[model samples]
Structure formats: structure tokens, C-alpha cells
Target: MTDITRKQFIKLTGAAGLALAGGVGAPALADTFLHKMVRKPIPSSGELLPVVGFGTSRVFDVGRSAEERAPLLDTLKILYDAGGSLIDTAPMYGPAEAVVGDLVARLNSRNKSFIATKVLQNGKQAGIDQMNASFHKLKTSHVDLMQVHNLVDWQTQLGTLREMKQDKKIRYLGITHYTDNGTRELVEIMKQEQLDFVQCQYAMNARLAEEELLPLARERGIAILCNRPFGRGALFNKVKGRELPVWAADLGIHSWAQYFLKYLLGHPAVTAVIPGTGRPDHARDNVMAGMSPLPDEAARKMMLDHLHGL
Candidate 1:
């Protein structure tokens, strides 16, 4: 497939028209909308990742039924067909890891994905045991990335992850935290720990990361995975009845979701933004945020001011 430029992709996807609940209304375009996945490099290793990644939190905890698996299968297909790769899940998210593993396998796309799962245990032996179970749930000998969830026993877990990395059981090591309480400690770890990635919450409403954490990550050469870029959908409530600002199209943002996500992608430190959803069209819309140029300093300020004024 030939790679399409940002404008070309927007034009292609935009022409498919819109659906209120999901994304493009055209099902045929779902399979052939465009062939580009915007990529950013892992600061620590120069490894490239798609700027738009999927998160499986509450969305993938489904029972083993054909009706339940059908939409997920389509979602993965749309993601892969659009060139997306990263699929972030954790043992904390109920059966998400297993469900994701099953869906990707059903789609024959296991090799095409960059699976990132987490270890949330506290002790060395327990951490080791949990991670082994994660591997089993993911149905993989090696995962693309393994993270210490919420910095829980990070020292022990990180050490275990390091050994696993050496053993090639995992390809990278990271740490994740979703609240401000952990920011200070996360900053200290980024300064001292040898980490490949850091996952945190950073949305327009939750801009705490902009003050120091984001800059620290950039300075330390750590890839940042931005979670809850939409403020867990709370930001949307502020703009419930408002239409997208006319200038949004200039940045290739056609929907509120894309606008919010594009705002996050504008930050240089953000390697990827993982937004959780179970709908295929919504996933398509999320990935489309990566297809356009990010906001510049002036545009970013305008976006902030506009949202704040509401």
C-alpha cells in the first residue's frame, strides 16, 4: 500500500462522512480508508511507534461468546488495516489482556501488534509470578513492552523486568501511573531508573504533567504514553453542544475527540496517546488523530484558551 500524506488521509476519511456514535459511516472505507499510521520514536531507543495506540481497560472484558468477539475482531481489523500497532492492556483491567490476545490471534495480527501489558504485584517472586501469568494470558513468548503498574513495588518489579528483558521475555521496560500523587516519585525515578517508557494521564483538563513531568521525560530520553487524553471523556461534557472551532479543520481536526487527542499529540514529549473504546468506528476516529500535523505553539495556545473560555 502506498503511504498517503496527512492531507490526503484527511480528505479520504472525511469524504466517508460521519456517524454520530462512531466514525465514518461508510463500512467499505473502514477497510481501505488510508494506509498511513503516524509514528514517533521511543526516545530511549529510537524505536518508532504509531502515535495513536489502543487501550483495553473496561472495554475488552467480554465473555467468550461469538456475539461479544465479533465487534472486537472488527476493531482489531480496522486498527491493523489502518497501520496501527500498539495495543496497551494490563492485568488490572479484568480480562482485557486475554481478550486482546484472543482478538489479535483471531485476526491473525498477533505478530503485527506491539503488545504492552503491566505487572501490578509488590514482591519480587510475586511480580515474577504475575508477569508469567501475563505472558500466558497474552499467549505470547515475548511481549513488546512490560510496565510496573502505578509504581507498585517498582524497584522489585523493575529488577524482574530487567531480567526478563535480558532473557528476551520482554522487549522493553516501563512504569505507569495515572494520578498526580505519583508524579513527584515518577519524576525522581525517571532521573535515576533505566526506563524505556512512562505512562501517565495528560489531557487538556488534566495539564499537571506540563509543568515538570513532561519536560523531565524529554530530558531523560524516555518515551511517554499519554493515557486519558480526553480526561476520561469528562472534557467532552464542557463542549457538549458546541461545534468544533472553524480553525480546527486547519489542524485536520473534524471532531471533538480528534481535537482533544490532537491537542495531546501536539506536545513533543508524547510518543503516543492510548484512548480506550470498544467501538470500531471510534477506534478509527482515534487513529485518525495521528494523520494530521500537530498544533504549533500559537495554535496550541489558541486551543487552550478556547477550551478554557467555555
Candidate 2:
């Protein structure tokens, strides 16, 4: 983290203290003492990214209404206030790219954010058109990262992305997939292409990535953006009536969301985990997972074992 980020965190914690004295809540107070936000370097460029980021899929595909956008605005504010910058979206997520652009514009956070959008079309021309549309919807001339969503026509789209990078329209290029079925192909592409990043699903409940995808990313020096960190909410369903283990408090984990996110963050190869949420409180809770004292390999194994028993 930068000195500016430390100052921002201190300032936010001071405000949280005031809120606590005003009887806000213990949870708010707990947030005040979290360690400095954790950041990991993008292996390709060495640019530091906060370990926790928010994703825009179903949650961000809202119409243009203050009523619909109010919570989203709060969510972005919470994310920025906690020093998080990466925001993932895609053209396939109906209206999500627009919603993110509008909200980030409203918050004046485009500069502070590392916005990542995708190309989901087939042919090269179609991919070019789709990426251009993403640039408009994201309200930015140049995107921080542009990815091939679900690897749809990955070869064609990747060629287009490389050209865009050369043209300075995108700073980095990557590919994404959400299931193990794509792991083999994803690995082959990683081996063949000089990608900067890869977004995929990874969580305690979804560990298929650990078998190959993650280690390969490490070896290839590609940053990883973990999606579906909660296994698309399947992990929560499994622990519906369960309580967090006693050791969770040692790692500053107060909620199950943080528990799950910290587990992913514990891994060395994970660059960041983008958990989707429209709720400000959930955003705040998720950002807390990026704080220090993450689980070690031993603790991660314990977490997995505990999850299995539940």
C-alpha cells in the first residue's frame, strides 16, 4: 500500500470511531482497527492492486433511477473508502457496464479505479465493435484491463485485444471463465499467450483451479482475479445455520464473507478476489478481508477441512 492509502484508511477509521461513539454499532467499530489494506503486485507489470475488489454482474445491471442506484453508489463509496480500486464488469452483463460507468462517474472514481471490462463477441470485427462499445459504456477512452469473457472466440478476441493494447486503448489483456470445464483450454492459452491477467472462479467450495490453473498462473507471471469467491453463494447455503470457527477472530474475520474471501486471499497466486455485491454493508465486510493477517497454508488447510465437515 502507498502512503496515501494509509492516510485514507486512517481517516476512514477515525470517522468510524466517531460513528461508534454515536452508537453506530460494534461491527463499524471493529472495522476501525483492521490492519492496512493488503495489496498484491500484478506479476506482469508489478502494479499493486488491492486484494479485495467488487464485481458487477447481475447485481449491477440496474436501470437509470436514483432509487435503483442509491445503494450502488454507497457500495462504491465503501469500496473506495477502503482503498479498493479494481471493478470487474462485462458487456454480456446487461446494463452492468453502463451502471458501473454511471456510478463511478457519479462518485468521480474513474481515476481511482482499475476498471476491467470484457469482449464477448465472436469474430474479430464483432470483437472490435463490442470492445468499442465497452469503452463508451465504461465512459473511458482507455480501459485499465480488457478481457475475453468466458473465452468466447478467445483467439480472435485476444488478437483484437493485443492490437488494442498496442493502440493504447487498453493497458492489459486477459481471459475469463467461471467453471472447471474451461481449465484445460485456459491453461493451454496461458501457456501460449502472453496474457497479463486471468479471471476465474475459485473458493473453498470450488477448488478445481488449485489443481492446475492457479499454479500455472504463478509460473506464467499472470495476475489472477478470482470470481464467484463464494461459489455463487453455494458456500453460504452450506453454512446457513453454522457459526464461524473460534480461530476466525484471530484473523479479523467477523463474518462468513470475510472468512471465505480471506481463504482465497491466503493463496500466493491470487492477485485479487472480486466478490459481487450491491449492498454497502456487504461491500464494507468484503473489503475487510483484504486486511493483513491472512491465513497461512496451514490455516488454509484447516479452513478447507472445517468447510468439509460442515
**Model 2 ranges with Cα > 4 A deviation:** 1-36
> Please, what are the lDDT tens digits per residue for candidate 1 over residues 1-310?
3433323443444533244313666557444455576789998778889898889998898999999978788788777776789999999999999998787777778888999999999799999888889888888889999999999999989999999999999999999999987777788888898799999989999988898989998888999999888886567667655667888878877777788888888899999999986777677777778875888778889999999988
Work out the TM-score per prediction: 0.91, 0.90
Task: Give candidate 1 regions above 4 Å deviation.
Answer: 1-24, 30-32
Which pairs clash in the backbone of model 2? none
List all candidate RMSDs to the true structure.
6.5, 7.4
CA lDDT of every candidate: 0.83, 0.83
lDDT score of model 2?
A: 0.83
Q: How much does candidate 1 score in TM-score?
A: 0.91
